[model samples]
Target: MSSELAEIEGQISDIFRALSNGFQKMDKIKDLNRRSRQLEDLTDKMRESKRLIKEFDREIKESQYKFDSETTKLLNEKKQSMIKELNSYVALKKRYASNIDNKRVDLFEGPGDGYAEENVMLASTMTNEQLMGHGNHLMDETDQAIDRATKVVHETIDVGTETAASLKAQTDQMSRIVNELDSIHFSIKKASQLVKEIGRQVATDRCIMALLVLIVIGVIAVIIVKIVNPNNKDIRDIPGLAPPAQSRRLLWHQD
Candidate 1:
């Protein structure tokens, strides 16, 4: 082992030793306040131990490449053992803490809160192991409840994220639909304008055709008058509808 890792492991071992001795002291200490203080000190030691473990982990990661695979595997196993030891101490701390709290409550309860005579009688009859077992069971249930709540919260967050995405997709679709509707409306409006323009063009064409008809009819009347009175010099012959000339008409009359 490297010197740095050795020093870290020593510090961690010292903290664990202190924690084990503190927990042993807690058994004889009847004063709840003193026990509470001892647990607090042990808790601090546990924190330091955890910090050292993290340092150890970092050291292993930094130096594992220098060692063979077997050496590296041993190092990892050592870390896991330390973690299991720390967890046992943590469980012990929780057990003692619960015992102290329950004792405090039992000491100061009012009559209305059901500090019943039979319960105290039963507690007196029960052994320390039974009480500890019951407390452990309660702690386990509480931990399980917290785990379930955490799972439910994560699931709810996932569902909410999916719902938000779906809503966004629906909103985008609606926006596209509205845009298409607007385009269709604009096309209809343009078609209406074109129809109006065509109607005006057709009306103007009909008026021009009527004017042409009137001119053709007037020319035919003038030609008929000229034929009836050939001497009228004021009436001129139209190119296509009137007689060709006085000479052509005289030839026809002579024939």
Candidate 2:
């Protein structure tokens, strides 16, 4: 019984450890989601900024229509302001890009012995036998991380490619101020669609979880009715009444 208790305790510890890891994974996913949201917001701001620049260009055209000679001078002033704003916006994007680059670099270079450090800490808590048995499983998690990272890399590459293609199409084909504004409008619409996609994915995840819970509750109910309740029936029988045993056996066993 002591050994059973010890094994149970170990199992429970392992379960909590798994729960902690799950929470950590949830946190990482949340961080990625937050980053995605930030990127989406940035994209929005970029589109708005682009629209503003285009509007300023429109202002130039209006000024030209009203004042032909002074139009050149007014247009130059407005154009300079737009260029300054754009440069500041590009600088902000550069900073974000740098931060992302640092994170990716650290992940690839392997930060300070990584899993080896985790293994040492884990080893301190277990007996040699337990460590030997579970060590392979722990190592397997490293491989899983690599696979997940590779998947993330591919996804990011796809996003980059799409973004580049959209930028190329807008810039190459839409040089006029009106056309540029339309392109910015198109980008905002695209962002809204992406947000809807994210919402749908979240809803899908929640529905699957609800279904799983219902399935588990149904299974437990069936087990209680079939196995647990029958055992409890004897306990519920009154002492004054003949024990249910002989009668139950006879009822079921009779040909």
TM per candidate: 0.45, 0.29
Extract clashing residue pairs from model 1.
Answer: none
How many angstroms is residue 57 displaced in model 1 relative to the true structure, after the best TM-score fit?
0.4
lDDT of each: 0.90, 0.65
Clash totals in order: 0, 0
Tens digit of per-residue lDDT, candidate 2, span 187-235: 9999999999999999999999999999999999998777755655553
TM-score of 1: 0.45
Candidate 1 residue lDDT tens string, 56-166: 999999998888999889989999999999999999999999999999988888543784677678778889999888779879988998999999999999999999999
Predict model 1's lDDT versus the native.
0.90
Indicate which candidate wins on lDDT: 1
Model 1 residue 106 lDDT score: 80
lDDT of predicted model 2:
0.65
